[model samples]
Target chain A: MESTYLFLTTVTIQSSMAVLFATLGEIVTEKSGILNLGVEGMMLMGAMSSFAASLYFKNPWLGVTCGLITGAFFALIHAFFTIGLKANQVICGLSLTIFGMGLSSFLGRFLIGKTGTRFLIWHVPILNKIPLVGPILFNQTPLVYLSYIFVPLIWVLLYKTNIGLSLRAVGENPTAADVTGISVVRYRYLATIFGGMMAGLGGSYLSLFYTPGWKENMTAGQGWIAIAMVIFSTWNPFRAVIGSLMFGGINALQYYFQASGITIIPNYILMMLPYIFTLVVLFLINQTEGAKRKLGAPASLGVAFEREL
Target chain B: MIEIKVKQRIAYPKITKFFTPFFALFFALLFGAGLFKWVGVDPLKAYKIMLSGAFGNFYNFSEVIVRGIPLILSGLSVGLAAKMMLWNIGCEGQIVMGGVGATAIALFASPYLPNYLVIPAMIFSGFIAGALWIFIPAIFKAKWNVSEIISTLMLNYIAIIWMEHLYFGPWRDPEGRGFPGSAIFPDAAWFPRYLGTRIHLGIFIVFIVTILIYILLNFTKLGYEIKVIGESELAARYANIKVTRNIFIVLMISGGIAGLAGVGEVAGVYHRLQQGLSSGYGYAGIIVAWLGRLNPWGILSVGIIFAGFMVGGDALQLNLQLPSSLSLVLEGALLFLVLAGEILPKYKISISWKKLSKS
Candidate 1:
């Protein structure tokens, strides 16, 4: 029973890491005046690229790096349309999603029926033995710990730093930012690309570490879930961590319960638990005063910024 | 010798709008050829194969038109919503609910209704289903000022899951040998064929709807109000256009049209609800609507062009040993290029010739 509990907790922690990385990445992107509807596609590309690389290189880190680059490449396309040319952010994002879906599907067809080397955590002598917390915290892959570190890093970067201030300024009013000697376009492009890289890394975590395998549409709708988590968290990176964990926990619990064969709830309904939770969270957030303050969202989010119209 | 002089100030043309798409298409094809080369396929041969497959046979041509019908309908849905500055991304969900509504009527109400009555009932059911699906987001936006983008998108997943549930469980056809799909509709419910081909009356319906929507957008009071609202909500409010009411009405209309596309898919083509009922037509409609600049007539033309891409992609898949995704890549590239191309006409680029020569 102790071994089983440890195994379950380990799975939960790893899955939660995936959610954490994706949600936090999306939070940054949305806060930069760019709503990336293509998160799903970017995630899929990352998953496939990372998986393919890991198979070829026999190293998970290489795979993860490749995933990040793949994500940035696609984000470049998004930036070109949305920031460079001032196209509709939503449409460009959607096009990126469709394009990514097609590209990933095509690539995945070739990668199908192939397997990659699985990633495993090296036990840290004393670190792996400190009871419940040890296995959950220390005896995990480097990416898992990095995801935990990212929450605070993102918080500081978004709220406490000079670069963050300028990023926020661009998001709030690009014209004003430009007037103030800030390159609004440059900041937006950077923020969007950074967001894409994080999303890619999150996808790599799924393929390279979490499930440690390749499958078509493996990211499924996790990209969209990350998007929802951004809203549910009200755009706070810290809160985003909690929201993602809750989602990850709910998702993990459903699978656990189904595996245990409790025979209480139907599996299909359990599958829908996360989405239902998202809707409830959306309602609660909308009802809250914090939502009115708009503390977390970029003011110019989703609006096209034209320099001289 | 002919000489072309570079002007110091870029002279932007307002009437070159027509040429922009052509330029964009040319560049898109050029990019597509480069991609083909990357994949180790001969671009010229692949292009020939794709074109012939899309337009070669009579049956294939009919299929393109048949596919274009739903695309046109969905494109009109998006175009109409855009005119009001309402982004209806839930057209996919609306289309699904529309299919469900039409299916519910065909399966349950067709037994007691006359053949003439069935078609109208199905169409109405579809419109109602689509409208109902979008009503929640519309209400949220109108009342609470919530972002419809997020709400409508979230609702899309719900509709998709709901659709999967119906097909896989309660609505599963008993005669389908365990396939997760609904029963095929009765012959009385099937749409009439056009010109002895597999193409149905749905194409004609799309054409009629396009013309009607063009009239509604160009000549009607509601269209004027929508235009005002799109231009400036403050101005529309000052003019007493009932912004909230119009928002609700326009969203419902957009949803209804999208639903009609679903109805066309089920009643006109499939005759039975299946798992993959829509091949992203609703999502693709967003691109079509934008590409057409939200004009109803333009929606029709772009819709057909998009359908051709879909058909050509399938051809590439079958004949050229290429993945169907190549078409998607080409389509996306086309959208990006077209958007960029359109921008050039609005804003001219001026280059410093002396600096260029120095470089």
Candidate 2:
């Protein structure tokens, strides 16, 4: 039973890393009042680029960096269109996703079925000796530990910093932020780029550590789940842990069921649960009138901001 | 310092609006050539291959039409919904369920129904099933003001999983050596096809549906409400439009149309609900709808062009050994370019080296 618990908990953390990174990134982006719906696309490009880079360079760290760069680069196109040209955020984001998926598939085609430098499990010295929690947390890849650092860092950056204040101000009311001598464009761009980098890092985690190696459409709806997680967390990085863990738990359960060859719950139904669960969460979040206000989206989430002359 | 000033256009030239999509295509092809060059393929040669592959012969052109049938239906589905400012990205799922729905009729009900009635029943059931598939998302959007984008997208994965379950589990054909698909759909369920070509009755069906939607969106009171609601939901409420009911109705119709695309795939093309039923036609519909500017007639033209792209992309794979995903790259690039170009007619942009002081 303890072994099973360790297995589930460790696998849960492993699965949660990607979503956690992406959700945290999106939280920052949305906080700055830009709704980028291209997380899936950005993540795909990140994963593809990371995998390809790792294979070429023979270093996993380089792959991780490339993934983040690719994600930010994709987000840059979105920024230029939505932020610079003032294009429709939703449509542009969709295009970004399509672009990412296509580009990744095309570029990574050669990398299919090939292995690359992957992050292996590294046990920390004394930390690995801790009873239950250590084995579950300490005995994992570098990316899992990196995720632990980011969750708190993002929380502090969001809720306890001047930069976070300006981001929130811009999202809540761009006009107000502009009057206070804040460059809404600059803050929004930075936040969006930062968000993209995080999503890229998440993608790297998938390719360099979690599943390891490049595969077409490897992110496989986790990017979308991260979007749902943003809402699930109510834009709080700290709360994002809960949302990611919930998703990771679902993934771990699916893995467990398949591994045990359990017929009690069909494999397909288990696969469907994550999506259905996301829908249900969205429904519940919006169902209550009070909850809608309390856990509302950023006031100007999808709206473009143009300063008045 | 340089400053770029953008001012909203009071009136734009009609020619710019008419030529924007073409220009977007030109830019996308230009970028596509750059991608080809990057991948060690000759740009001009690649273009020549793609063009010839798509339209070199009557047979190829017919195949393009066969492909365009689904594109048009899904495109129309997306375009109609977008008219009311709704994004029906779940058209993919709707298409899958539509196949399942039609398959149910073809596999089970065909024996009881007369030969003439089977195809019609499959079409009807497919449409209804697609609508039902989207029912949850529509309700969430209408009642709770939830983002239909996420809800609809989530349902897409669910629908695909369910379809996979059906084919891989209970619906698996036993007689055909344990094949992972249902028994062949009876001849009664087979859609009427043109001689010596894969083209089916879907052409006429799509035409009728397009015209019906065009008339409904233009000449009708509900059309006016949809327009007003799209412009401003507050204004729609002030004008006594039943906003919630309209949302539900429009989404159901949109989903139903997308489902018909699935029917075409199963009844008109595959003749069985199996793998390759959805080849990203639903997602491709988004590009068509946007490229067509959400106009039914425009969607028809764009649908054909996109189908040509798909065929050409396959040709690239066959001839150059390039990934067919290159076509998707072109489609995505086209969408991005079109979106960037949209700023042109809407706003007049001017750049100056010196920053303006005060006014």
Interface RMSD for each candidate model? Answer: 2.1, 0.9
Q: What would the per-residue lDDT of candidate 2 be over residues A124-204, giving only the tens digit for each residue? A: 989988997888889999888887888888888877899878889999999999999999999888888988999999999
For residues B1-359, write the lDDT of model 2, one tens digit per residue.
88889788989998998788789889999999999999999999999899889999999899899999999999999898898889999999999999999999999999999998999999999999999989998998998888889988898899988988998888887785767677789999999999789999899989999899889989999888888998999999998899999999999999999999999999999888887788789899999998998989999998998999999888999999999999999999999989877787888889989956786
Indicate the residue-level lDDT of A122 in model 1.
66
Residue A35 displacement (Å), model 2: 0.8
Error at B182, model 2, angstroms? 1.7
Assess the local accuracy of residue A211 in candidate 1 as a C-alpha lDDT between 0 and 100: 72
Model 2 DockQ class: high
Chain B only, TM-score of each candidate: 0.93, 0.95
Number of the top-ranking candidate, with TM-score as the measure: 2
Query: Model 1, DockQ value?
Result: 0.50
TM-score per prediction, in order, is 0.92, 0.97
After superposition, candidate 2 runs with Cα above 4 Å error: B1-9, B345-359
Scored by lDDT, model 1 comes in at: 0.82
